[model samples]
Target: MTIIFITTFSEVHADLAIIAHPDYQGGELTREMVKELFLEEKLEFPSGHKAIPANHASGSPDRKAFFEYVLEMSETRHKRYWARKVSVGKKGAPKELASHKEVLDWIKNTPLGITYIEKTKVDDSVKVLLTVAVFDDL
Candidate 1:
C-alpha cells in the first residue's frame, strides 16, 4: 500500500480602517499624516484637535500589519525610534490596548482617539480616516 500527503495553503487579506471618535473633527488623514500621528510626531490634527493614537497590543495581527503598512517600519525599528525619542525628552509610543473591542470602546469615549482595526469590525460609532490593505499567509 502507498500513502501520499497533501499540503494546502491559503492567503488572507484584510482592510484595516483607521478610525477616530465621532467627535473628532480632524477629517481624513493622508498616509504620512497617519504615520506621524501614530509615531507621536504630529500631536494635533490640521483642525487643531489633539490626536491621540491608540495601538493594538504587541504581537496582535493588527499591530503587526499597521506597523508594516502604515508606519512603514518594523517593530524593532519602531521600538528603537521611540527609545531615542524618549531619551531626548520626547513623547513615547501610543497607548496600547489588549484587543479591538477595548480600542473601539476607548475611542468611542475619547474625543480624539485614533486607532486601526479590521474594516469589517467597524461600526457606526467611529469615523474611518483611512483604509490599508493587509495580507498574510496561512
Candidate 2:
C-alpha cells in the first residue's frame, strides 16, 4: 500500500494545513502513469491546455516543473478516459505540515505491507510472507 501526502492550494507558497493520503483515490494517478509510462511520453501534451503550475518566486523551479508534468499527464488521461476537461493545474497553496512529528506519527501508525489472515490450523501458527508487485490505483 502506498500512503501519499497530498494537499491543495490556490496559490504557490501559501500555507494550508490538511494533507490528505488519497488525493486521487480513483485511478487518477494510475492513468497518468500509464500514459506517461514511456520516457518520451512524459513530454506529451494536448491541444489548448498550456497553463502549468506557476512559480512566481522561482524557488525550486524544478519541483514545479515536475508537478506540471504529472498534472498534465493526469489531465490528459482524465480527458481521454472520462471525456471531461480536467483542470491543467491548481496553484499548490503553500502547504505546511501540521508538524514534523506528524510525518513520524503517520509512519509509525501505518502497517508494513498489508496483512491477510488465513484460517485453517489445528492450533495456530503465524507466518510472515514477502511479496512484491506494483499497486495500480487505476
Candidate 3:
C-alpha cells in the first residue's frame, strides 16, 4: 500500500496608501494619527476642515489587513466599537465603499475625504499622505 498527501497554500500581502484630497495641506500623519482617523476619533483634518473618511467594506481583504495591521483590531470588534460610539453620539464610522474604485471616486469628489487603499490603486488625482505595509510585522 502507498499513501500520498497534497498541500496547497496561497498568500496575499497588501500595502496601504493613505491618500487625501489634493487641497489637503494638513501635513503628514503619524501611525497613531492614522489609527485615530480610521477609528473616527479624529473628525477634522489638521487644517480644520471636517474629514470624511472613505473606508473599504467590512469583507474586503484590504479592510481586513487595515484592521489587523493599522487599527490592531478585528472586524467584529471594530463594528461593535463604532456602534457604541455612535449610540452615545461620540463618533461615526467611515463611509464604507465596496471597492477601491468607489473609494477613489469618493475621495476625488469629496474635498476633505481621506482613505487608505492598496498602493497600486493610487494615482495622480489624490495626494498621498502616507504608506504603511499591512504585513510589516510578518
Local distance difference test, each candidate: 0.88, 0.26, 0.81
TM-scores of the candidates are: 0.87, 0.17, 0.83
* lDDT tens readout by residue for model 2, 29-55: 232432242222332223222211111
CA displacement after TM-score superposition, residue 2 of candidate 3 (Å)? 20
lDDT of 3 at 48: 76
Which of candidates 1 and 2 is the stronger one according to lDDT?
Answer: 1
Which prediction has more favorable lDDT, 2 or 3?
3
Q: Give the per-residue lDDT digits (tens) of candidate 3, residues 36-138.
A: 8778777777767777777799888778877887889998899899889889987578889998888888888888888888988898999989888765332
Give the candidate number with the greatest TM-score. Answer: 1
Using TM-score as the yardstick, the better of models 1 and 3 is 1
For lDDT, the strongest prediction is 1
Clashes of each: 0, 3, 0
How much is 115 displaced in model 3, in angstroms? 0.7
Candidate 2, lDDT over the whole model: 0.26
Regions of model 3 farther than 4 Å from truth: 1-12, 136-138
